[model samples]
Target: MSGVKMNNVIKQYGEIQVIHGIDLQIKDGEFCVFVGPSGCGKSTLLRMVAGLEETTSGQMTIGTRDVTTMDPSERGVAMVFQTYALYPHMTVKENMGFGLKMNGHPKSAIEAKVAEASGILKLDEYLDRKPAALSGGQRQRVSIGRAIVRGPEVFLFDEPLSNLDAELRVEMRVEIARLHKEIGATMIYVTHDQVEAMTLADKIVVLRLGRIEQVGSPLDLYRDPDNKFVAGFIGSPAMNFLDATSGEDGVTIQALKMTAPNPIGKTSKAVTAGLRPEHLEIDPAGDALRVDLVETLGGVSFAYLVSDTGEKIVIEERGDEPVSEGQRVGLKFDAKRLYLFDAETEQRLRA
Candidate 1:
């Protein structure tokens, strides 16, 4: 296992700059995820680390070796791509050990490595089966097993679960998590899915428009984001934002027709107040919210509402009975849970 370091890494196509002076460090044996929306340069950055994309400028290191200009095969990194590129003609065992065989590894060594990888992935039963005979999840496992047999210093996964169905994605997530724990390898994963980032990452690098927005543990970014974008992107259903005018004691939200205490003390400026879906509660005496829709997902429900200001909000509800559309329900939240951001800068207002 090895750590990765990027010092002022920059990538450009002709005169158009995409990645701009990115600096980051991934520790050895850490499960670090690069998460962002499409065209955010997450995949481009990962490709640079894998030696597949040439770094336009800056230095990159895998462990202590400078691999900025190294060949892909000499970078000591194994990449598992979104597509399962297993050979249809080869059996699972042969597919997993193909790299070793191509590299002139002895037949006995290839068999031993394949066996070890299959044991770790629980693919011993399917070793004799070809890629055509395996399910989607099984084929992906074979792809991962192929990477494991190489014993590279770092593992790079570029949306490895995008091809699987929703249920199989969850199952494969558990499998990958278990594999990381058991192997304790340094893994770098890239995905646009925040749910996958929150669940599978030890540390998440949130990127926007080729620059890093934030990097921290999933819960830290969710609970204490540095900006409104990070707050909105880190959580499910996203954080609700409403325009407010700062007052001496607090801010007045015209939409909810309520005054919330301004803990940050930055008054006299236009601000935006944010509330997570799970934080809002339905209270009879609180500000009125007109329910527009309700989504019931088994035990928990989400009530979509529009406040008087025409701002949309979603509130998580838990109970047998849920608020229906057209119902006017009062909404309340803890003062501590409310997030205040500068309307112009979109940065969090701190006390």
Candidate 2:
């Protein structure tokens, strides 16, 4: 197993630079996830580490070796792509052993390695089945088994579950997490879904536009986001941001018609107040906002509310009180739970 390191890594195509200088560290045997919106260069960054994309500058190291310019095959890393990339006519066993066969390994060695990987992924029964005869999840498992046969020092997954349905995605997430633990190998996964990152990562790197916005554990980034972008990007319902102005009394929220703590200490400066859906409490006595929609998913529910200024907010409902669409309600929360960001810089106002 090996840790991966990037020192001021950069990538560009001609004159148009896509990935800015990025410095990251993925510790040995750690599950690190790179998450961001589309076109944010998460995939590009992963490819660079795989040696599929050229690094215009800076250094990349795997373990203690400088693999900055090494070929993908020589980097001691195995990649499982979004697409299954399975051979349509090959049996699962054959496909998983194909890489070793291509490398001129003995036939018996290939079969032994394939069997071991199949057992680990629980694909023993499907070993004789071709890609066409397998379900999406099974096919993906075979694809993963192919990587496992390589026994690479690091494993890389590039949105490997995007093709699966929601149920299969969840199932595969558990399988992948289990695979990481069973193998205890270094793994770097890339995804646009924050939910996957939250559930799978030991450490997460949040990217935006070609640069990293923040990097930390899932809960750290959720509870103590450094800026508005991170706060809005991490949570499922996302954080609600309302425009406001700082004053002597505090920060006055314009959309919700309320006041918040002024942690900025910059009076008269424009700011945005952030509140998470789960943290908000409904004040039925003060009808300042109107519920636009209600979504109940078994044990939890969410009330979508709209303010006079047309700003929307999602409030989580897990209590006994029932909130229906079109009902009028008010929002309240503790001052300590509120997050304030400078409107101009979009940075958190640390007190």
Candidate 3:
């Protein structure tokens, strides 16, 4: 129901610092996701917002309230963690209404709120069942229902689907997305999975080594990444980086055995060329790169390749074309689609 803001927030434990100063804003009724690899401090950052982790320095506010030092119970935020954390002996209805009951709400008020949340989360049929009887997806929905019953100012989910199987993860993603749409509350979710971030986020904050890497809409980060890390981390098959150098006329990609018309020409700086797997095609006529492996995931097939220089490349096979392992091939792609990055800094080289 309210926006969240962090201004120069830092988290440190004695001598070591985990979260470097981070400043970010999540708009009201927005679904914001924090995504990064393990130990990138994504979870630490999420916990700071939830008041689960103490803020060593800086300020955090939910709506107009500065909750930097606020306790979890006082923060006006409800969190759904990776674990369900449900009471095994309590029925789904009791589990959902327990918080309200403890707060001294009348039985009628508790029942009404529990009923409302159950309807929203499609948990009505499981109301009488205990945690032992519910499926993983159903139990997780009950966990979410508990959060919904409180009607907090914001919702926090810390990789709520990590414990589920792939199919259940997909189902819960839809459930969570729908919950957000129905409630229209400010929500912050944390995950190491880029696919979830791409699918569910209105705004994504990419982090690395306790520092914020970049923030933008899912498509914006995928189409125009600020650095090699963002470009690689946002996509499924990921963007391929190859050894390249700039010369008199253009940039030469050693792995592709081709020179592209440089957007910024005539530089002697060494660079890395990035090509998305979807933008390239395997050329059977040329023998510069060899096909190492092909992975076919039904409609989409990926060809893993290695060049004479031993650089690896991954290309999504167009038209689901057949490619054999050990077949020597060449790579073809739009010259304009090529992305250049500084070799040392790994930063994008824009024209």
List the global CA lDDT of all models.
0.94, 0.93, 0.93
Model 3 Cα lDDT, one tens digit per residue, 91-111: 999999999999899999999
Q: Write the per-residue lDDT of candidate 1 for residues 1-351, one digit (tens) a residue.
A: 799999999999999999999999999999999999999999999999999999999999999999999999999999999999999999999999999999999999999999999999999999999999999999999999999999999999999999999999999999999999999999999999999999999999999999999999999999999999999999998999989877677877777888888777765889989999999988766546898999999899999999887889889999999988888877788888989899999999888
For candidate 1, the per-residue lDDT at 346 reads 97
Residues 106-209 of candidate 2: C-alpha lDDT, one tens digit per residue: 99989899989999899999988899999999999999999999989999999999999999999999999999999999999999999999999999999998
Where is model 1 poorest over a 10-residue stretch in terms of lDDT?
A: 280-289
Better of 1 and 3 by lDDT: 1
Best by lDDT: 1
Candidate 1, number of clashes: 0
Candidate 3 collision pairs: none
* Model 2 bad stretches (over 4 Å): 263-266
Worst 10 residues of 2 by lDDT: 260-269
